[model samples]
Target chain A: MLKKRIIPCLDVKNGRVVKGTNFVDIRDAGDPVDLAKHYDKAGADELVFLDITASHEKRDTMIEVVRQTARDVYIPFTVGGGIKSIDDMRAILRAGADKVSINTPAILNKELITKGAEIFGSQCIVVAIDAKAKGDGSYEAYINGGRVNTGIDVFSWAKEVEKLGAGEILLTSMDRDGTKDGYDLELTRQVSELVGIPVIASGGVGSLEHLYEGLVKGKASAALAASIFHYGTYSVAEAKRFLIDKGVKVRW
Target chain B: MIGIIDYGRGNMSSVEAALKKSGYKFVNTDDIGILATCDGYILPGVGAFKDGMEDLAKRGLDAFLKEVAKTDKPVLGICLGMQLLFDYGEEHGGAKGLGLIKGQVKKLTTSFKIPHMGWNSLELKRESSLLSGIVSGDDFYFVHSFKVVPDDDSVVVATCEYGEEIVAVVECGKIFGAQFHPEKSSDKGLKIINNFGKLVERC
Candidate 1:
């Protein structure tokens, strides 16, 4: 069976991992490369390094961090945040990143997705969507750290992006970010049903059960969490073991 | 020195890195002279069958490789490199392969996934120098949509279960092929490569 993936996302700022409490009150976790290697040893199926820093100095440092991590870790790794151009994608990929995730830039220029897919294979491109539920019971697209609302329907954007040649969708619910209440199942199901590519559910994985529920009920191919994993609340190996015991096929 | 055939596919760096880490002398090359002088050869690839075969043919390394294989120099193929040892591959319509192994590479019909990408336990089917340090149930990383169904079952060294008994490693005389990347698979992967290194050393 296609094994379910458990991923640890490291939010990198100024070449260091900055873990926040519910996406606020950020603190230094550790060196990004060291943390990535630790997770890779802990049997993380994949790792995502999001460069959250806006400074030029930090951007280059993050790229170097990714390069170092790729040298040590053999498993697949995805780098995201501020990937503005095809050159940026190439730089990250050439640095040994298997895949590049784009959010704000992809939204600003929809053709960027197609252009990226053309240069590098579609399998190397991941489109991450941050969706938040509206009062009218519709989900809206948010960009730039969930500060800017695109007002685009989540399902529509997902389908369009898939058509634009995205190999996978990294769907995160802003409303559920760091809540640990559970994954926003409705958003996951809606987007997953609309796209043919793999959907990685993100934003609100609290426990092993949440991981199971996200994959089983939410129909996500993989699940991503930040705080729980970064804070050592749940180790990836134990979570995978729990899921495997519950009949979820996970790669140990 | 072991020569890892570079046909512009993935797994080249990983193989080289693993070999270096294992304390083995190796070179990644497409040069025919280097391959001819090497103690043994390691063919590593990751992509479609037709594309891989085209790469070998374009470099004129295919004929050179066949000639080398005939000399009993011990050549190992990893992942797509393993599939290329067969007579044919069903990927991209159909394509001709190296014909070293009497088999046809066909797309996997397992219910697991299209691209079986992850670590899976191997079931050793037979004993060989390639299986020297590696044991049964040892997990290795695999990422492919097609698998080789060897015409000669005796050549199979190991098999793994996904939905069916898929060939994981095959050893026939001097030619050994592993459908998994031993380099990217950590310790077990390195062990498989190390065993190949030993085989070259013995030769």
Candidate 2:
């Protein structure tokens, strides 16, 4: 069987790794390239860099960040945030990122997903969904750093993107982010079952048991956490060992 | 110098970076003449099977690739590039491949997931130069929906389990194919590439 992936996400801002609480209160963690190498050594299945930079000049720096990270670390890496077009995807992939994640661009223009998949192949395109629960058994996709609600139902948008040829979905529970309570298992399980593509469950992981829950009960192909790994609460290798002991197969 | 074949698809930067890190000279070229001059070649690409074969055939690199396989010059195909080494594939309306390997590529019948993305441990089938330092249970990054179903089992160098017995690495004479991306698979991955470098150093 395919192994359940334990990914350490680096929320990068200004060439450094940073994380926030419920999408705010951002603070620095470490250098992206340094943190990337750390995670690689720690046995992370993959690494995700959410480039939170906003300036034009910094956009160039973010590309350099990807390049440095790719060179320093030898694992499948993904760069997201500020990616707007196929050309932007091209630059990141050229910088040596194995994949590129899109959220705002995907919500603003669903065609970006289709065009991206066409130009770069669906395997390299990841559609990130920050879904805020609507409290009516439905969730709305949020964009602009979880500040604006797209009003697009998460399930509908996920299915739409799959139809548009997205290879994977990075589904994060906005309400559960930074809670450390656990992943939104109900949401992840529902979404994972709804789509054929692999679903990466992001946001809200507090313990190795939580990782097991996410893989077993949440039904996610991969579990992505920021602070849990960044804060040294658990090394990815330790977490994988925990999962394996719990009868969850993982790549070690 | 190793020639990285540009089939008008996929990214070659990581492959070049890995080759450079391994201390081997490389040139990304579509010119078969330059390719013929190189010690060996690395075929790097990712995408649909039919589209990949079409691009290779369009540039006349399809026959050139087969010709290279005929010689002792090693050819390493990554991901979709690896799939194209087989006879044909069931992906994208059933396309014909280079027919270097005995079998055809078909969509994975595993009950697990599609694409099979993420890292998985390899089960080395037998000894080969490409797996010199690499051992069984070593993890490599894999991302693909279709896998080669070899008619002859002896070609398989390593197998990684993911529902069905997925072929991780295959070596038949001078041609080698990896379903995983060794370039992006961290240190263990580079070790595999380094072994290939040693194989090509003979030329």
Candidate 3:
């Protein structure tokens, strides 16, 4: 049986971790590589660095961060946000990051998904979708940090990406984000069932229960959280122990 | 020293880093001469079996690896690299493998999931040095769509369940293959790599 994965996402800005991290033992909490190494020690299954860098000139910093992390960390890690082209994907993967998640670019040029899959293999190409439920019970895909709505149906776009050779889907509920509420179970379960590829349930994950809910109730293959892990709410090992006690198979 | 084969396919960085952390000296090389110089070889890959085989052949590594497989020196294949050790595979219209191991790589026919991604615990079939210091049911990270079907069940030293008994580790007289990415599998994974390193050192 495949074990459910717990991924800690780090938001990067100008080569530094943007979100406030509360790991006291870490000398430089803002350092993505150090925090990544810290997370690996804490037993994180994988790590994701969402580069929210404003300037393109500073983008190389993220690559450097990825290079250092890959050199130091043994577990798999992913670099997302601001990745727009095949060349960008190449630089990141070449830096030793196991996978790269694309959102805006995937929505803008769906062909990138197919091309990345063809070039780098589908296992490395992850299509992340930011979804917001509409009043009519339909969810709409958003781009630009959920600021601009693409007006594309989340479900249909997910199916399209899978057809285009995306290996996994990182589904984030815009409505649930930052609420500390929980994952959009209906959104995650429906999408997980809708596609054959693994679905990583992201967004509103406030507690271990939420993570468990996302894995069991939402039917997501993996659960991703940032604040809960960063703010010292729960260690990855603790979360795994909790999941294990609840009978959810997770890597210790 | 171990030679990490670079065949123009798959993830080589993680293997290099893992070996380095395992305190083993290694070189990333495609040169058959350099690979021959190494005490052991680690074939790490993450891609299609057909592509992997084609890459090895294009680089003339297919023959070189086949030659190495006959020797006492260890040749550890990871993920797609492991599949390439098999005689044949059903991936991408079917393609011939390195034929080092008596097995065929076939698509996993399980209702659980395709690409059986993430961590899964191993079930020990028998005692082997590859799993030294590792407990039964120790979790190892795996990410693949196909599984190898060994011609002889005795070749299989370890198996993991994902709706069925999926081959995890196989050791046939020094030619070892791990369907999981031991490098990406964290501590226990590093231990396995170190065990292989120790085997190579012994040689």
Candidate 4:
């Protein structure tokens, strides 16, 4: 059976993790390597380090951070944020990142996704979509930390991205993000049903039941949370234990 | 000294860095003479089976590996390198392996996921020095779609359930192959590497 994964996402800037209430008013979390090691020790299925400011910076400092983290922690680590070209993907992978998540660049140039999959194999590329629920009950694709709206339908875009060779979809719900109400179950289920690749539910998750809901109801292969994990509200081992008690096959 | 085969796959620096940090003397080379002189060999590989096999053939390391296997010298294959130890693989149509072990690498047919990329626990099946300090149910990092099905199941050291029981580690005398990358696994991963380093000293 495929075990459901619990991932803690870290947004790194200038080598330190910074968290925000709603992707703004950033506060320093800690060193990425330290946080990553802690997560690894806590039994996190995987760790995601997003260089939120990769495009603004001239050099990719995340590579060094990833290298350091990979040395210290044994779990798989994924790097996202800027990742525009194949060279960026190559450099990160060479730096010891197990997977590379692409967001803005993939939406801008669809070919980059296919190229990444072709050169590095589909398993290495992850397409992260920041989706915002609209007033009409539809979702729109947002990029640059939800600052820019691509005006593309989230469901259509996810299907297209899958067709473009995205190994997995890291779907983030901007509306429910940091709300802690729980994941947008309906949105997650819709996307997961549309795409064949593994869907990692991101953005809104408050408790162990939310993670279970993401896996069981939302049909997400994994659940990623930031505030809950970053604030130490719940450890991955505890979450996995709860999920296991609920009969969810989690890697415990 | 440990010899880590470098055939332009991916991430040889980190592997070398890990070995060096662990206080083990090692070199990354494809040259047969230099590789053969090493106390033990660590075959590390990434990317497709076809490309990896082509690079091994181009460097004439294929026959040399067969000779090393015959000597029963300690050799460890990580990730794609581990896949190459089998008799054949179904990646990119089909490719020939090093034939050190009697097995074939086939794509995972699980509806769960394709890559199976993340941290998963191992279920130890047999006892061996390669897993001396490792415990059953210890999680290890895995990132591959294809797994080895050994002709002789007794050779399997550990297995991980991913829709099916996939062979995680296989040991036949001095030759060992881990489908997961120990250099990339973390603490348990380092312990496995340390065990291999000790094997080098014994050799």
Native A-B interface contacts kept, per candidate: 0.09, 0.69, 0.67, 0.47
Candidate 2 local lDDT, B16-48, one digit each (tens): 878888988899988888888998888889988
Q: How good is the docking of model 3, as DockQ?
A: 0.74
**Tens digits of per-residue lDDT for model 2 on A205-224?**
88888888888899999999
Q: What DockQ do you compute for every candidate structure? A: 0.26, 0.70, 0.74, 0.48
Residue range B1-203, candidate 3, lDDT tens digits: 89999998856888989989999999998999888899899998888888888899999999999899888899999999898999999988999999998989999988876778889999999989999998777988888889999999999999999998899999999999999999998889999999999999999
Interface RMSD of each: 3.3, 1.5, 1.1, 2.6
| Model 1 spans > 4 angstroms off | A20-24, A54-59, A84-87, A105-123, A135-138, A156-166, A190-196, B110-113, B131-138, B163-165
Best by TM-score: 3
Summarize candidate 4's per-residue lDDT along A1-252 as a digit string, tens digits: 446788899989999898766687888889899998898778787889989888888545788898888677767778998888999999898888878999999999999999998888787889999999887878999998899998999999999998998889999999888778888998999999988788999877888889999999999988998878787788888889999999987766
What TM-score, over all chains together, does every model reach?
0.85, 0.96, 0.96, 0.92
Q: Estimate, for each residue in B1-203, the C-alpha lDDT of model 1 and write its tens digit.
A: 89999877643555666787788898888999887899999998766789889989999989988998788799999888999999999987999999999999998887653356556778888888888877776767776678999988999999988888789999988999998777767666777888899989887
Off by over 4 Å in 3: A20-29, A54-57
- A78-129: candidate 3 lDDT, tens digit per residue: 8898888999999899989999999999999999999999888898999999
Clashing residue pair totals per candidate (backbone < 3 A): 2, 2, 1, 3
What is the model-wide C-alpha lDDT for candidate 3? 0.89
What RMSD value applies to candidate 3?
A: 2.8
Task: Write the residue-wise lDDT of candidate 1 on A1-252 in tens digits.
Answer: 346778888989888898654557788878888888788788887788888764244467877887788677766778998889998888887776767999999999999899887666566789999999996768999998888999999888999998897878899889888788889998898787777677899987788899998988898888898878888898888898899899987776
TM-score result, candidate 3: 0.96
Question: How displaced is residue A139 in candidate 4, in Å?
Answer: 2.4
